[model samples]
Target: MATDPVTDWATDFDHTDDRWAADPFPIWDDLRSACPVARTERYGGAWLPTTHADVTAIANDSEHFTSRSVIVSGHRPPVELAPAGIAPPISADPPFHAASRRMLLPVFSPQRIAELEPSTRAYCNELLDGVRGRDVVDAAVDYAQHIPVRVIARMLGLPDEDGDRFRGFVEGVIEAVADPREERIETFLGLLHYLSPYIEARQADPQDDVISLLLASDIDGEPLDPLMVVRTIGLLLIAGIDTTWSAIGASIWHLAATPADRRRLVDEPALIPTAIEELLRAYAPVTMARLVKQDVTLAGCPMEAEDWVLLPFPAANRDPAFFDRADEVLLDRSPNRHAAFGLGMHRCAGSHLARMELRVALEEWLRAFPDFSLADGDAVRWSGGQVRGPRTPPVRVAP
Candidate 1:
């Protein structure tokens, strides 16, 4: 069997055996400059896109680059966790995706998110209140991780008590690299089973919450299939909880590491929105997967059908071709079209909500403890690939 170099790169990319997760940008930089489109032998002969333009082009052209299943690798994600992986005509292509996105957009619209501001602020303040007198606090666990899960759970009409358990389940699913594949599959199955009753209950008695709304939604005048509803909920849970948690942690870490950036925001509270965008761009939380539906040429390279495309948004955000001083935290980065929320039809529906959460978090933290730093002997680091985030960010409050 002649192995594909692209699949090999993807396999290596997936395992991160080379510790590429620690700093994947460098690898992306090399790929963007040298081999914008390269073959990896790992993902069963899939192609990998590393450059900004290539990724952007593909992400925008959902028609050409379909998103059905795992595009980078032909493997099907376990059925228990299959909603995200299932691609179109229905799952992979537009019009259908566009309609699905529309059904869920209002749930996270700017106006709706504004209504969530008070609660989000309260959550941030409540978390910070716990460590008010303490010298050091694990921001990742104590603060960052809690807000997103709690808020998202509330949005989904789930009880607050389930927040910690749900977070644990998601963490297990995302960080099960060392565990057997069966364990990961079982974990997600358990998650689905656990939520099964809720789905039924919501169906029987729909409410104002996202789950209830989803349960009652119709696509093209057809009631959403139960399986699709479950999958959509699963996607929301993972995206809303994990990505926001990671972003909050990363944002706090970035602030702690660079006191100047913190001070700038502190002095000009109005800069929080710009600061948030810059932070999101600097630390893209989600890795994208797209499938090649047909033979296509991009960035002077050719890709055949079934080629897996991994769009490294984090790397693209840092590309010099698009960003000036891509590494630095420019709080006032205007006209920043970084694909943090992704691009096109399949872009994150909860982005507005995530932005509101982050903005309020930063606001409350700075107001509550203006002078804060990483605790002595405590350093922050990130983990996971498809979902990257802080291992634990420790902050020392200066009272």
Candidate 2:
């Protein structure tokens, strides 16, 4: 049997390419059919998983494919990811991941997130209110970016004023690829220092927020480690904010580009929930990765221990075998079991919270501006192949 040249070409991975941010699905599709599980020359020579089934298998079989390593290569692991990377036998295995995940379950329960709907909607309304009279606005800057940060901050019981500071810190960290190494280190250290006092305050005087809950949580009757608490909070903040912000940007971009689709959504406002699922499926803002814990064969390919596997979720969501007309945005996509929030025990803990935020934001935004389009001469920019979405989506609103 002859090896496919398409697959061979895809094996040459580049984690820091600007082109990947523009359109990775076309490359991912070619790789999935030609080489579902293949090695990549990028990331110290890692394996890349392109198929939906392959990603699901790895995500579910955490014992074989572990999350103990930082999902991405080429950067220092964030302090928050340290505990997650060491998630343990439970982290790697079952019952333990379940048990550890259970500790924070209540915090993100549907009811808890639902309780936040009014506040989330209010925040969206407030942001849009400011731009209501304006002819144009960058959804990324005006709405998509602000809503998540505010929601996360409010959820953490942090002051609203810290939103911009945290945003700066995150932007600095994410844009580290473009900045000098020393500057990146300085930004990370600054973030750590900024978070230090919050960790201390949470310890001294706990509150109703997730951070306090984590700080006060105990596993097997032992209190959670304070450092672990800090790391978890940091991860939740970054994960909840950045990925969703980009997703919001992408979803809006999609709606603006497709007039009929936007019209359908605007007319049947009830479709917002379904639209959220479709948006997530079509524009998965986050790309994830895992490490091979031991030598294993997947889709006839032998993966060695310590090999990194990049799970391109956006690509998987568009798999034709799993979805019909996968590229088209079908607002009411029933049985849409996309991997947008991931799968298995390590699934995103804040999935429900994120959904609620999106639902409210979309419902409110469409109602306010049904005739919106991308601003003239403005193009969308994206970064981080491992984690990506539109960097800037300038949109013009019409009355």
Candidate 3:
């Protein structure tokens, strides 16, 4: 049954409210119950669809919903994406989206990830070893944040030494509000410049790196435009970093707090897979946006062309309608079809890599410190907008 959205205060849903961003579950739970299809006039007028069914339906309906503008805050009227009219294949609609995905499929394939696992495990151990002797360490910065950037760097044939620079650019891209508009532009340009040489070199002399693979890949019987190649590389570099970082941080935050879950994962090693899935479901970090392509009714809400919808997958993962005891993180829960990575065509292409990093990361970390908890009197600080995660979750590592 359709209902008119509570228009008065609904538009004022403050995504930037610091207290709410730290723990948004209560607010989202209330909205899902009272006004699931709430409209927010902020971010140039957007509708936040915060239900499992609504988000899933909208994501799958590519004809009615366009992926052109996938962020709530940055979308403007006429629905524009960065580098105007140029979007990475991740946010592009089919058949080009499908084509771009095909190009990336082999790189993240299960077989390829298996080959990369030994190096990933070794890197995970190295990160932990560096923090082994510290009395207290920032779980987010010292450990979680470093792994993804280094891994992505290795795959792209970029110098692992420059992982810090890549991290800075990724932090900027996900938190657009945190930076001034011009700063965002500079970050984008800086990244484009950093990746330009690789693209050019790959075209001339192919190698095993992802840039080379993308250069060799074709679109509709023709090589992708130089601009597309550059944008795709930029997307991979930026998009690859913080997403898994957030998941890893959130998982450890829980483990540090929940003694039972930590011990179970340590003792019953077989439970790690389901535990990882539960962690992802409970702490899914990324929220994507879509431009309403045309007039369409979704979950009884009338969506017009040019209207923007914020698909909060994190909220969907916690929907009680879909899962039993939705709020609890049940490590062994079966039939867990969560939207942590997202749904449909725009689902994360780097999911395999993320899973491997998370599993190896947890395995290695738990092995290093058999017991750990959040540092006393140290409150976890989180960042909101686009992608959200703990920026500083200090932990008291035990011997």
Best by lDDT: 3
Look at candidate 2 and tell me the lDDT of residue 349.
81
CA lDDT, every model vs. true structure: 0.74, 0.74, 0.81
For model 2, residues 1-399, the per-residue Cα lDDT tens digits are: 111123243667655565566777777777767866667655556777777888788877765776764345544343344235533312334444555688778888998888999988988999989998888888888899888898899888778887788778667655444455577668757866777788899889988887788787877787877766666666667677887888888888889888898999988998888889999999987666777777999888788877777777788898888889987888888989888887767678888988888888888889889999878534777766456777688888997
Instruction: Show model 2 residue runs off by greater than 4 Å.
Output: 1-9, 75-96, 172-188
Q: Which residue pairs clash within candidate 2?
A: 80-231, 381-391
Q: Give the winner by lDDT: 2 or 3.
A: 3
- Compared with the true structure, model 1 gives a TM-score of 0.89
Per-residue lDDT over 49-104 for candidate 1, one digit per residue giving the tens place of the 0 to 100 score:
76677778888886567666532323545433322345222243555666677778
TM-score, every prediction: 0.89, 0.90, 0.93
Which tens-of-lDDT digit does each residue in 1-399 have in candidate 3?
112233343556655556555888887898889888888665556788788998898889888988865655443524545222345776787766777888898899988988888998898888888888888888889999888888888898788889888888876676654345577668778888888888888788888898888777787799877778888877877778888888899999899889999999999988898899999999998888888788988767788887778888998998999889999999998889999898998899889999999998999988998789889534898877767788889989986
Residue 198's C-alpha lDDT in candidate 1? 85
TM-score of 3: 0.93
**TM-score head-to-head 1 vs 2, winner:** 2
| lDDT at position 298, candidate 3 | 77
